[model samples]
Every structure is written in C-alpha cells, then in structure tokens.
Target: MTTTQSLPHWNMDVVYPGLQSPEFAQGFAATVKEIEALVQLFDASHVEKQDVLTVDDGLIKTFETAVEHFNSVQDHVLTLEVYISCFVSTNSRDEVAQARESELENSLVKLSQLDTRFTAWLGSMDVEQLIAHSEVASAHAYALRRAKAESLHMMSPREESLASELNVSAGTAWTKLHANLTSQLNVTLELDGQTQQVPMSVVRNQASSTDREVRRRAFEAELAAWKEVAVPLAQALNSIKGEVNTLAHKRQWESALDASLFANSIDRQTLDAMLSAARASFPDFRRYFRAKAQALKIPQLAWYDIFAPLGSSDRVWEYSDAERFIVEQFGTFSERLSNYAARAFSEGWIDAEPRAGKRDGAYCTPLRKDESRIFTNYKASFDGVSTLAHELGHGYHNLNLAERTALQSFLPMTLAETASIFCETIINHAAMKDADREERMAILEASIQGACQVVLDITSRFLFEQNVFEQRKQRELSVEELNGLMLQSQRDTYGDGIDQQTLHPYMWAVKGHYYSSDLSFYNYPYMFGLLFGLGLYARYQQNPEAFKQGYDELLSSTGLDDAATLAARFGIDLHSEAFWRGSLDIVRQDIDAFCELVQSQA
Candidate 1:
C-alpha cells in the first residue's frame, strides 16, 4: 500500500542478505545437494516400490515413506527458487542475480526430471493403491491424479527433455525478447515546453491522466515508441504462436485453443459458453459505455479516454489512510482476511514503489514453505485501493493454501481470481455504499468502467488473437496489417461504443499476454476470473455463512478439479450459457443503476 510516508521495497534480506550473502550461497548449494538426493532416491526406489496393487506396510516402506521425504526436500528447493524470482523482479539487470538464476535453473532440471518420473510412476499405479497409501497420497491426491490423467499426452522422457530445450531457444526466447524490447523502449514526450524521454511503463500510465492534452500526447508518444519495435514485436508474436501451432499439431491437438484448454484442465464446452456469453453481452456493455460517454460529456469514448478519470476530484490517499481503509474493509468480511493484509503490510512483503526496474503490473507470488510476496508499482491514485485489495486478495488465497502440500495448492486461471476479484467487489460495494451523491456517482462510474474493460475489452483481445493466428498461418503480419486486425476486433467486440477512429491499434505490441507461448489466449481467463468471481460473490450475497465455507472449499480445490467440476460445488454448470449470462446479468444490473444515476443528473 502506498502512503505519504516513503514505502520500502520488499526486503529480500529476509530471504537472504544479498547475492554475495552466505545465506544465498548456502541456500543454492543446499538445493543442488538436495536435488542430487532426490535423483538418486527416485532412481533407487523404483527397484523397491514395485507397481504392485498392494497397500500393506511393505508398500508404505517402499513408496509413500520416500515420497514424504521427497516433498520435504522439494519445498526447500522451491523456497530457494522463489527467492531468486523476488531478487530479479525488482532489479532485472543485476548481473550477479541473473548469472545465479541461470545456474539455479540448470540445477532445477534434475528436480523437474525427477518430478516427471514421479508423475509417470504414479500414472502406472491403481487409484485404490493411491487412496490406501495414506499421508503423502491424501496430501497430493489431486496432483497425482491430474498427472496420471495427463500422462496420456506424455512423450518419452528423452523427447520431453528435447522439447523443453527447444522451448528455451524458441518460445521462451521470444517472450524474453519482447520483455527486453519493451523495457528498453524510449518514448519522447514534449511536456511543459521541453522534450523528455519516458520509459514505456511511465508513458502508458499517462493514459489515465486528468489533463486531456497530456493523455493525447502520451498516447501519441506511446504509439511513436511502439512503432520503433513493432516489426520486431510482430515477428516475436508470429514466432511464438507459430511454435505453438507447430507443437500442438505435432502433439495431435486440433488447434492451439485445444492445447490451451488441456493445459488449463478445462473443457472446450465451457470456453465456448463463456466466449459466446461475452459476445452476447456486448449490447448491454455498449449501453454502459454510451452512458459513460454522456457522463464524460463526450459523444463516444476515444482509445486514450478509455482509462481517463471521469470525476473532477480524482482522490489520492496517504499510504497510512490506504492501509486503514483496506484493513477495515477486509475486517468487515472476516478477521482471517484482515490478518493476512495486516501481516503483508507490516512485514514488508511487498515492493510498493514506482521504480524504473520493477515490473508494470501487480502479482502475488506464492512461496509454499513461507508466505506469498506481493509486487506492485504503487501510486496512491483513486484506483490504488483496488490494486492493493486485489493483491491482498491473492495473499489471502495463498494463506488458505499455505498449510496444504505445495503440489495440491496450484490454482489455474479459472478459479485464481476467486479471492482477488471478490475482494475488489467487497471494497467497491463498501465504498459506493458510504459515498455522497457526487462521490457515489463517481465511484459507480469507475467501477463500471473497469467492468467494461474486463468483459468487453477482454473479448476484443480474444477476437484479435483469433484473427492474428488465422492471418499468421500464411505469413507474418505487418505493423499496418496487425493494426488493422486490432481495430477491426475492437469494432467487432465494442461495437459503436468505442470511437473507431480513436481505437488503440498497437495494443498487440504492448500487452505481454500475447507474447506468452505458454498461456495462449491469456485474455479470456481474466473474463472468466471476473465473471466466475461475480458468480461466487452472488452466492455469498445469498448466504454469507454458507458461501464462506463453499468459497474456501472452491479455492482449495482449484488444483484438484477442472473448472466444470469445481463449479458443481455451487451447483454451477459452466457449460451452460445461462450460468455465464447470470454473471453478465449482474453487471447489467450495475450498469442500469449507473445509467440511472447519470441520467437523473441530466
């Protein structure tokens, strides 16, 4: 949380003193030493733990005993790795950190190999045997079952190894290239009668500027900057998607979309229902946008104006005030959640500054043995509370899974937003409930504005990616061609609400989601997160006590079951368009209220 008092960057000193610290050196050495033990033990245990269906004490001596130990060493290894992630995130250019990270990554290969072997080994065992094994089996039951199910797609160990190596030079390389390209990007903006070089991150934040001239100039500067890297970025995107296309085809998948579904452990029917629901909800979204345009005193909104603040007083806060608001609001929900945020803020578990090297977005990274650390480029804007709440929501999610085995705590995109978005909804509702007429209108406007982005703008991103892949099949897309596709997607998704002439054409260039070969169509998951979160919030609204237990169960079971299976806990059928539309309907209700508020003033 940002305060008037200077905030400190995350104290990696707790993880280790420094790159040259004995703790860092010893931790890395211990991890490598532990990896060797895991490797030798995994190899030797095969001779002992026969794939017998027996669940006797002899079987426990053979496999389960060894697995519990393996998990212990594995947790230590993870703690070391996550420390490196924290080290590099705030200072990407630390050569010592970078060099050590590369070294640690190489050592991690052995651990990964052992994991694959373990997964494959479990795949051969009968379900009843796993259930009978007790401790380790009960702890990581979902992870083991998921691995066994996915072992259907497993290549040979040697082939899998080669595939990973190829990804390093192929897909991973391009993602890195995109990161390096964007971070180094210099956009010159003429402000206050002088020219200054702006980092791409700083320039993009200007889109939310209250001053229209500044917003327009910033957009222009960002466009100019993106132009310099457009060719390379286009190539980067083409290469990344092309690699996925090649891999999926070789793997006998129908398409990259199919591969994405499998990786997320979700079915095509659910995705179809979600996307179709999004497209159908466009009319209501446009209506909200039209009302917003009136509220902003414009006929229609422009690309830069999309994020522009609507009210005259764009409230900023002291860091202390921000902390109190968040803690009090969270306490209104539950004491457990408030305690997590209190600890995160008090313990310096967050990097809360807008520094040059820190990443643009906020994320909570889970360290299984310890707690999660949140990273954000904090500025005490009106939206700062939402950002803090969102991250703390993630922290709370981590806290729920903290006591569980590391393997069982993995959350996929579908349920990952459950806590974070729900936290946002809680805080948003509280703020709106307490505000005066002027403040209430402003708050609702801001809330609906963000809702428009996730629901409508996210859909536009999905369409743009679909078009990009289709066009990218024959040849690489030129900057103009890519820009054309983006504008068309925006028109198709946003319809007449967003002024076409002022749409962001170079959106594909800045967004890192497009660059990830691993998470194809990274856009819709956010839509799912928002809508899924809303759906759960609705349940909470009905019976807070009943929903609280079910909500915790849902988050805990995310890694255990697929999207459709987990939704069943709340009697949700994700495959039904009606289920998704139910969430959209909630948004429509909010929009209607906002529109009425604005029109009453008229």
Candidate 2:
C-alpha cells in the first residue's frame, strides 16, 4: 500500500526555504517594488489611453522599455505565485500560505491594471509600424496584434481596473473556497474489514479497484461527501460563472465561450470541427463500454466501473518502476526528453502521494523555464505510470519554451496539452509492444479508458458547463438543478454505454475546472490536446527524422502563433472536419482492439 510517508514530497526548498523565511520575504518585497516601478514607467511614458497613430524613435524606445520591464515583472510575479501555490495546493489548510497567496493576488491587481493600460495604449498605436521599427515589438508581433484586437472588447480603463481589483475578492475568493473545501473533504468507507475515514482523493482512486464492491462503496461515499458540501460548491460555481457572464457581456462578447475562444487562440470553426468529430465518435466509445461491461459480467457499466482495470497484470508498477519505464520510453523518442524525465525524478520535482488536505487530480506546474513540479495521487497501476509520463511531457514542453520570453511562452490551453498527451502516447505504445496477452489487454484497456474520459466524459463536462453558463445568465442554479444538469450531460454523451441509474450527478462538484473565472470551457481543451497529439504522433510514425527536427520548434512556437497558424505549419487544417475525423479514427482503432480482446477472453 502506498502511503504519504513512503511517497516523495517535492523539494520546494530549492525555490525558497519557507514562505515566511527571510529570503522569501525579501523576494516578495522586491517583486512588489518591481511591479510599482513598472507602473511608474507606464505613467512616466504617458502610455495609458494614448491615441498615437504613428511610431517614432521615442515611441519605439518607450515600447521596448515597457515590454522588457513588463516581462521581467511578470516572471517575478509568476515565480512567487507558483512557489506559494506549491504549499497551498499540497495542504489546503495552510493558513500562512493562503494569506500570502491573497496578499500576492492583491499586489497583482496593480499589475493587471498596468496590463490594461498597456493594451489600450498599444491598441491605439500603429502596431505594424511599431513592429517594423522595434525589435521587441517585432518578436511579440503576434501577441501585440492579438492584444490590439482584444482592445476592441475592453471596457473603459477605470472599469477594467475595478474589475481586476474586485476579482481578488469575488472570483478569486470563490475559487479558493472550493479548493480548500474539496481538498480537506473526507469520505467514510470500510477497508480491510474495518471502517475508516479516508481523504476524498483516496476514495476516488478506488474507482479503479479490482473489487466491484469497493468501487460501488467508494462511489456512494464520494457522492455523499460531495453532497455535504454541495450548497457551497454550488454557490462557488454560480458566483464564478455569474461574474464571467456579466463581464463577457460588458466586454461585448457574444457569450462566455466566445471570450474563451479568443483566450485559447482558436476560432469557433476549429472548436466546432473538433467537437463534431467527438460527438460522431460517441457510438464507437459506447461500443467499447458495452464490451467492457460484458467482460465484467454486468449488463451496463456504472460510473465507478468506467476506470476499472479490464484484465489481469502481474506487474505492479511502483513509483521506481514508473520512473524507470517513463525514462526508458522517453529515450526512444529523444535523449533530451529521457534526460529531462530522469532529472525530474532525481531532483524530487514530483509530489506523488494521496494524503488528507491534499488536492485531488494531477497537474504539472512550471516553476521556471527549465523546471516544473508534478503533483499526483499515484496508485500502483499502469495508469499511475502513464500519468507520470504525461506530466513529464509538460515539463519537456516548458524546457522547449525556455528560450522564449515569459509573454512569448504563454501557450493556449488547446496547445498546452500537446506535449503531455504526446508523451503519454509514447509511454502507452511502448508498454504494449512486449506485453503478454493479458498484460497487453490491460494496457489497451487503460489507454482506451483514458481516451474515453478525454473524449466522452469531457464532452459531458463541456455540456454541463455550457448549460450552467446559460442558466447563470438568469439566476443561480440550485444544487438539485446542478445535479440534474450533470446527469443529463452524462446521458447525452455516454449514451447507453453507462447504466442510466448509476450516472454520477455530483461531477460538477467534483471537477475544479468550473470554478476558474479566468479560463472557461476547460473541458474541450483536453480533447483537442489528445486528438491533436495523436495526429502528430501519426505524422512522426510516417517520418521520424523529419518530425524530430521540427517537433521542438513547433512546441517552442506555440505562444508565438494561434492554433490554426501553428497547425498550418504541418499541413493540418484545424477547421477541417476530415482532420478531426482522422484523429478520432485513431481512437476508434483502439476501441476496436479493446472489444476484440474482451471477446477473445470471454
């Protein structure tokens, strides 16, 4: 059994000794001072609300200095934020870290105000002429042009500043409330013939247990736990979405999703194409689900059975085994990647234990251009190994962006998953190559299960969030109403594959994605990443050497262009239904293989 004592806690000391340490205090104070200096520079240059239509030497100089100083200030702010988040996320009850985070957020409001001023000033200028004259502007031309376009959607400077300041207490507070509540939430369950109270993350992890009774009990306990906090979580969801809806309208967005599309650097057409393909592939996913149910000797699958292991594997993948396997598989793709994964392991960059007060789910957060930290509730299964590889992929992506400025490295959510999913594919494919029949079946089932969540389950989340946003426009939804919406979404996407009576209605409360005010519609981006990464993997198979030469550059340039432009570099038409269908075809093939394996065993 994996315990918190046995698993690694990340070495945050490398970033700072402690949140209250003298070094951290000095750094935090300096970051505040730097932000204030940037504001002074903006004021001195008269860069706010300027209506300059021409570019000259003085203008070029001001633009260059502002861009450089802004980027430097952003780096400092992000470093401090990420450092504090390391503690807050791992232990939600950390009052000191929470207080510091709030303080940092308050300081960041000024930076946000400065950004509004800068965007308005840049939007009013002759951006093309500025780009032509200034090296900094030219390097950030894509971002500048996008910012100028976004300026059309801005409120007045005062309103924008007020919104930024208000968000520190409004949206930010709600988001933090949900995080703290869920992280500390526990579920009562019976394990080893004794009753025990376990963290929600631990209970959730049992959904993949070999024992059906355990999965069912955990599911019930998990639902009850969520129910206990449903009212507040519902309020959190409503407040966040309500804020987003009001702001979207104030900014002249067609809807909240319209704003998200702009933020993700993708057009509606691209999203439509991808989602259409995903919906069309639902029947194929349903087929896989039915086959898995048959293998488990059930008429239909419960939500708990969705992640259940389908075949026996004698191999138990402990943390060390996962580390070694990921490093080895990554080497086959590139030595650079393998070395990076190895370094992540040796340097204690991963927190891989599920404990009380620790948040559920896994994420890879970049600490700097060259370093990242991965958090996961790792189980002793291949699924755990695959997750580790996925996060290392994110770290590798960060490394590629090391040469770019912070602004230039800020990739959209759609493209952000590219490297992680690609790395996960590498590990999955490698694992299946030499496995025995049973092991192969297990690996194939695991891979298909993951893809199903990205495709089918994520579709449900997308639907749920969309409905919430629409309803939030009128009034806040009751917890029961929210539950009903979740169930309806599950039925719509999962169809007959999952048992209707056993659908998970509290998923809205389970997922943290809905609480984020800055990023809406976070569900579909995972689907985009998976399909896009699979498409890229197919290309690599066709021409390994050619793909290798350009892969890192493509990853590096994600922030430099929109999704369509970046996709165009490899002859991928993001708006084409055929391109999306081709990617879904890859997943369909896996579904086919899974069905065959299940039938053969039966």
List candidate 2 stretches off by more than 4 Å: 1-5
- Compute the lDDT for candidate 2: 0.91
TM-score of each: 0.93, 0.99
* lDDT over C-alpha atoms for residue 121 of model 1: 68
lDDT of 2 at 407: 75
lDDT of 1 by residue, 147-264 (tens): 7676556666676566666766678779877876776676799766789986777787787777778888999899888888899999899999888777677667778887777767
Model 2, range 338-394, lDDT digits (tens) per residue?
999999999999999888899999999888768889998888889989988998899
lDDT to native, each model: 0.78, 0.91
Model 1, residue 106: C-alpha shift (Å): 1.6
Error of 1 at 294 (Å): 1.6
Give the range where candidate 2 is weakest over 10 consecutive residues by summed lDDT. Answer: 1-10
Name the best candidate (by lDDT).
2
